[model samples]
Target: MYGQGMDAAPNPWFSWDYVERNWDEVSDRLVIHTTLTLQAVLIALAIAFPLAVLARRIPRLAGPITGVSGVLYTIPSFALFGLLAPFTGIGRTTVLIGLVAYALLVLVRNILVGLQGVDRDVIDAARGVGYSPCECSSPSSLPNALPSIIAGLRIATVSTVALVTVGVVVGYGGLGQLMFRGLQSDYRAQIMTATLLCLALALLLDLVLALAGRWATPWLRGRAS
Candidate 1:
């Protein structure tokens, strides 16, 4: 019996039926990951945009904010989640927090880079024409900065997709669940399938974003787009 038990193993990577049998689970997990990533990216954007604007005018605030976000970027997903588990507890909230922290650097840096890339002459012209800081920052600076911001967003989108897959380590609502099951059961086939699916999704997302960015920002067609 012990010998039989040892011989009975899970082969996730090679198991087509494994994936087919759990299609609903895989689809649900994908939805969860998508929602988590989008929400995290959007929230990070909200926080980063204003900070970027502030950084442009203040100059002093930029360094500290960038430094902090950079640090957040360096923290490993599992470690961050583990650390947050105490304060935030487990499940979706903790996962969301971790994803947001991970995204902060990409989102903030992009916003800052976009703002910094704005044409000095345009800004100067806006100021000279009696445009308020708000006006100059919005319609004027924004247009020039759009491409850089979108570029950053493009980067963020890719990062977000990848990070969302990682969220499964938290054992909640991600493809990670499938991945974890495969690993736990020594199911290589399922594992391979899950991994490939994730890779495909990430690649597809990058392609779609690239197309959208190019369409949205004509200037980026050369570099930014």
Candidate 2:
């Protein structure tokens, strides 16, 4: 009698019936998951851009700025959630804070690298034409750095998507909640659904960014052609 339930067959990965019954729930969670990911990435970019620009302009500060973000990146995701939950109190806020912190390293490094990579010739030309450092940066520096910035954004956005699932630690992980519940119940369909959606979301976002990057950098296309 005690072993009877253990003899039952395990559930299959794709349970149409389960999805049919829970599609509304899945849709709601998916929206939450996407919102959290986008918000975190956007916030990180806003913070990282100025930091990257400052680092580029002041070479001495570059190391320390990147170093701090690198340190934040190195901390395990779940551990960060655990640490923040105490102060932020376990929810979207705690999760958003953690996601944003983790994204900084990639976003900052990429933006700085992109800025540094801009043709020195362009900077010299801008100076030769009477552009102030400030005027030159807006028109010449950032535009030239777009590819690298876009690349950084793509990486940060995808990384944020994955990190959002860790929000389960704070009871705010959108699809992550489903994965957690599935784990407890050994429900294969629920876990697979959430995992697949996460993967799909990442791919979709990456594709969109890739397209956007191309659109923004027509010179590269012109050069290639």
Candidate 3:
């Protein structure tokens, strides 16, 4: 139907003119998007590690801690922005806070699971052989758990990249801002560009994390060989 409409001038989805005219805006948005994704993931990782370790250390608190994270993850992004805007005001900070909160559930759970998965006997043996708690955990537990923690990082980063677009609601959604405007104006090119860039960013981050995981866990490769 769209192709048959010869009465209207052709409106293509790929327009060099669009990129040329809005190069600065698009580039700025991409940088903002990357900044938001990176900062959120890093902050979440910092918070998650301590929480995960605490949960592992204290078996009684593990369920409540993870349950709270699950609750945080289930809150809709827009709803989070709405709730935070009144307190933090509409800005990047609000979005960053929400993104970090969303990432916590995945990161904390994965780290906890990985730590739990490490064989108890390994730790016991290390303790029997005169290793301190610090040495046993660092050399024995965390390394074995590195794969799961890395997996969580990859998942959280990709999820955060996608979620950052929802921040357009608070006027700081990075590329999401472009996509929102495009939607309002029915600008297909802008919409496609934003969508594609988001996907590319997520994929790039995931690939990097995957490679990092493989490098961190060389024993898996050695075992297979």
| Alpha-carbon lDDT of model 1 | 0.76
Error of 3 at 165 (Å): 0.2
In candidate 1, what are the lDDT values of residues 46-112, reduced to their tens digit?
A: 8877777888888999999899999999998878887888898778988888888887788788778
Cα lDDT of model 2 by residue, 14-63, tens digit: 88888889999999999999999999999998899888878978999999
TM-score of 1: 0.85
Backbone clashes (count) for model 3 = 0
Candidates, ranked, lDDT = 3, 2, 1
What is each predicted model's overall lDDT from 0 to 1?
A: 0.76, 0.88, 0.89
Cα-lDDT of candidate 2:
0.88
Candidate no. 3 TM-score: 0.91
Worst 10 residues of 3 by lDDT: 1-10
